[model samples]
Target: MNERITPASDPSTWGRALDEAVNILSRGGLVVVPTDTVYGIAADAFTPPAVQALLDAKGRGRQMPPPVLIASVQTLDGLATGVPAGARALAEAFWPGGLTLIVRAHPSLAWDLGETHGTVALRVPDHETALALLARTGPLAVSSANTTGSPAAVTAQDAYDQLGDSVALYLDAGEAPGQVSSSIVDATGETLRLVRAGAISLERLNEVTPVEGPTA
Candidate 1:
C-alpha cells in the first residue's frame, strides 16, 4: 500500500515527509512525485534493481533512459564530466525549474548512472518539496509517472489512478504547476539540440543556444 503525502513549499511537516521519502528511496522503493512541470516516478539512480522496477512500473523499455534529478547544479559535476559552457548557461538560465541537460558521465561515477553509452540526462526541479527530498536522497532516476505511451500525470489523483499499487509513495502536492513536462536538450555534442519540446519554447531556447539547427 502506498501513502499519500501532501507537499508544501514551507511544509509544516517537511521533516517527517523528508524522512519517509529518503527511507523509501534508500530502500529502493518507487516514489511518485511532483515537479515544476509534470509528476515523475523516482528511484535511486545508483541501484540497477530499482531502475528496472521503475521501468517495469512505467512499461518503458531500456531505450527510454530515465532522467536523473539532483539537489543542486553543484551536484552536476559529481555525475557528469566537463559540462559544456552552453550547458552551464542553460542551467544557470532555467535551473531549479523545468530543463533537462544531457552531459557526458564521469568515468568514475559511470557505472551507477546506468546505460547512456556515456551520457546522462539531469534536472533540478523547481518545487520546494521536490528539492528538499532530492537534497537528502542524492540523485534519483525519474520519469513521467504513467504507463508508457499514456498521458503523463498532472495531479496526485492522476498518478494514483494510473500507478495505483505499483509505487510505494504518492506525493500529492496538488496538480502539476506547469501542467506539462520540461523541455529536454542533448548537450552531448558541440551544439545543444532539442530532444523533446514541451513547456519551454524553442524561441526561448534560441536565446541560450545559437539559432541554427533542425528542430526535432
Candidate 2:
C-alpha cells in the first residue's frame, strides 16, 4: 500500500506533477485528483485492472461504475456512440463545467468498465490541474474520492484520509470548489433524461435542449 502525495498548486510544479501522474496512469495505478466540483480517484480508462482497483478503493461494486473524464469535449465521440443531437447540444453548452453525458459506448472500444450495459458516462472537467492530467493521460475512469455513502472529498487530504494507501498517488491542487457534483443526463434513448441534478439546473439545461426529469 505504498502511496505518494504531490503538490500541484504551484505553476512551476505542474510539469513535474503531471509527469508523475501520467506515469502512474500508464502502468495501471489510481490517483486522487482535484476536480472542479470535488476530488476524484482516477485510473486509466483502458486498463481493466486499474479501473477495478478504483472501484474497489471507493467500495462500489460493478453495478455503480465510474465515469470517464476526458481532456476535451471533442473526445466524447471517440469513446461513446449513439450520441443524439440533443446530447451534442448539451455537451457543447455545458462541457468543461459540470455536466456528465451518459451515452452508448463505442462499439470498437476494447476496454471494460464493468456492467456498463453498453453505456458510458463522460465529462470534460473545468479544473486546470485535472485537465492537465487528462491532456496527458487521455481518458480516465474517475469517481468521487470517498467510500460508498460518504461525503465527496473536497481536498486531497480528505481523499487520502478515506482512500489511504489504496491509491498510488494523490495530486494535491489545494481544495476543490466543493459546490456540487456534475449534473448527469442519459442521452442513450430518443429523449434526454436527467439522471442527477447538481451544478447545472434543469431550467438551464432546457435552455439549450429539452430534458426530462422525474416529473416529466
Candidate 3:
C-alpha cells in the first residue's frame, strides 16, 4: 500500500515521515518527493534495480537517464569526476536551487543510471524538506514525477495520480513554487553549454561562466 506524509507537520511527525521515506528508499522502493521546481519520483541511485524501477514507473527508457539530487554541494566531488571550473562557478552561484550540472561520472562508483555515457547530472534542490530527506538518504535518482511526455507534477496529489502505488511514499508539502525543471548545463565540455533552459536563464548562467548556445 502507498503512504502519504506531510513533511510540513510538527517536528516529531516530520522526523518520522523522513524515517519512513528513507526506509522505503533503502529497500529499493520509489518515493514521490517535492523539490524546489516540482515533485519528483526518487530511488536510491546506487541500486540499479531501484533506478530501473523509477524508469519503469515513468514508462521511460534508458536513453533518458534520471538526474541525481544531493543534500549538499560538497557531495558533488564524490559523485562526479573532472569537475570543470565552470561547474564550480555555477554551483557556487546557483546551487540549492534550480541548476543542474552534467559532469563526468566518477569511474570508481558502481551503478547504472541508464545511458549516461559516463556522465551524471546532479542537483541540490532549494526545498527544505527535499534537502532534509537527501541528508538522510544520500543521492537519489530523481526525475519529474509523471509519465513520459506528461506535465510535471507540482503537487504530491498530482504525482500520486500518475505514479499510483508504484511509489511507496508520497511527501505532500503542498504546491511547488514552479512548474518548470532546472536549467541544465553541460559542464563536461571545454565550454559550458545550455542543455535545457528552465528556471535559471541563459544570461544568468553566462554571468558566472561563458555558456555556448543551446544544444541542437
Candidate 4:
C-alpha cells in the first residue's frame, strides 16, 4: 500500500488525520508521529507482529526494544509492576515531558515488545498531537523515527525520507519541539540508574529524586 502523509495541524484535517492514524494503528500498521522531542514510529503495543515490524523498519534487533508511550501518568501502574518511590516522584515531577522510566512489566500482560527482559520502558510525551493519538490508541510501542545509525527525525518529511513506504502514514504537525530524545532511567532495581542521557539532565532529574549514572 502507498504511504499516506496527513497534515495534523490543519484544522480542516485534524480530526480526519487522527481518525486515520487510529485506524492505521488499530490494524497494526506503522505511523510516523510528532512528539515533543522528535518524531517516532508508532505501532499497537499489544500486537507482537506489529512491534516486530517496527523494529524491522529501523533495522533494529530484539535486544533493543521500543519504549511504550502513554497519554498520562495514571497509565503507568497499568503497564509496569513494582514502580519505585523515586520513579513515582520523578513521574509526577516531569511526566508529560521528556523522561522515560524502565520498570518491571506486569507479568500478566500479553504483549511482546521483544527481549524486554521483564522490563518495559515507558514515556509520556509533551506534545499535543502525540498525546491526542495516544488518547485514541492507548499505549503505543514507539521508537525514534529513523533507520538504524541515522539521526532521529525532527519533522514528518525527514521521517518519510528515511522510512518511506515502511510507514503507513505520517502525522505532519511540523517540526518536533526538541531535537534531543528523552532521558531514560531504569527504576526496577533499588537505585534509579540513568540509562541514556538526553533532553533532561541528571541534575534536573535529581532535583525530583536521586538518579545515579548507568551501572558499571
Residues 79-163 of candidate 2 have per-residue lDDT tens digits of 9877899999999998898999999999899888889999999999999899988888889999999999999999888889999
lDDT of each: 0.83, 0.90, 0.91, 0.93
Q: What tens-digit string does per-residue lDDT give for candidate 4 at 1-216? A: 224778897656699889999999999999999999999999999999999999999999999999999999999999998899999999999889999999999999989999999999999999988998899999999999999999999989899989999999999988888889999999988899999999999999999889998767
Model 3, 29-145: lDDT tens digits are: 998988999999999999999999999999999999999999989999999988998889999899899999999999999899999999999999999888989998999999999
Candidate 4: misplaced stretches above 4 Å? 1-3, 10-12
Best by TM-score: 4
Candidate order by lDDT, highest to lowest? 4, 3, 2, 1
lDDT of 4 at 131: 93
Each model's TM-score, in the order given? 0.92, 0.96, 0.96, 0.96
- As for TM-score, the candidate ahead, 1 or 3, is 3
lDDT of 1 by residue, 1-216 (tens): 335644544577667666777888899899888889999999999888899889889887887789999989898889889888888888888888888988988878734434578889999999887888887888999999999889999987788788888788878777888988898888887788877886787788789865234464
Model 2 TM-score? Answer: 0.96
Worst 10 residues of 3 by lDDT: 1-10
Write out the backbone clash pairs for model 2: none
Per-candidate clashes come to: 0, 0, 0, 0
Model 4 residue 138 CA deviation (Å) reads 0.5
Which number leads on lDDT? 4
